[model samples]
Target: MLMAGCAHFAGRHPLLGYTEKDHPQADTALVVCAEQEQYICGITGVNQVATWEKFNGGKTPWVRVLPGKQVIKLTLSNSHQLNRQQVTIDDVQAGHVYRIDVGFNATLLTASYTDLGKMDAYTIHMPRFPLSPKAITASF
Candidate 1:
């Protein structure tokens, strides 16, 4: 899956250097993608903003991150509406690649990933993906 995302990114950014070969020394790296769907994703940590993908119909590139056990919040928005889901993976380890697969359909929100082939198919208990955070935050 690592190579798959890398191949798709042809002329995007040089920072898309995400592979199973070389990794960060101390901190873990994060790569999030919306699969089988499209959504505008906003990633936030504590009070810091990480990244966001708007009208993302495909998977996103890898996002480098610090090593720590923290709760990273994500708000996904789409054309229809918006939704929010906070996901916490295991310990963020160094030299490891953390991939997040997000998707949504008519009924269920699908979020899952593998930790360097260490973890199995872990399902994220969320309402749905393809979620647009715009409408939701606007409600506030």
Candidate 2:
């Protein structure tokens, strides 16, 4: 598995396929699967859909995609179950960063997105699954 620590150093080489080496930061949009405690989330596929051999079992936290409408596949998991969810973001702007947030809302496993680049923050609800309270609580 590939692991990326939250650190950076001068002259350090970038991770091939994981860094912005190929996808320039100024023209590509980034989808970040922020680490969470309530559940585990990972980016599985970006538009142009590559093979699972590069998925690293969803351990990679972020992916770069061309600006415009893009479909992202993700793996979401809690203590009781695992699921794959596909989210479509329309009119994705270049040089902007978007984040996928997954959480349990007492009744369902919820996913949403936020445009971090904007000041007027808003959340777009994505796929959701009905999971019982017992199942969610068991994780604790």
Residue 40 C-alpha lDDT in model 2:
75
Maximum-TM-score candidate: 2
- Model 1: per-residue Cα lDDT over 1-140, one tens digit each: 55435433321421222233364333444434333346555453322543443323322233545556645566656667666666676576555555556677786455555566323222222222344322110000
Candidate with top lDDT is: 2
Q: Give the TM-score of candidate 2.
A: 0.62
Where does model 2 exceed 4 Å of error?
1-23, 51-56, 105-108, 118-140
Candidate 2, residues 25-118: lDDT per residue as tens digits?
5566567665576687766777656423232444445665667788877788889767777678898776566788987767656677887672
Which pairs clash (backbone N, Cα, C closer than 3 Å) in model 1? Answer: 76-131, 77-131, 77-132, 77-133, 78-131, 78-132, 82-132, 109-128
The runs of at least 3 residues in candidate 1 whose Cα sits more than 4 Å from the true structure, single-residue gaps closed, are 1-26, 34-37, 46-62, 105-110, 117-140
RMSD, model 2, all Cα superposed? 11.3
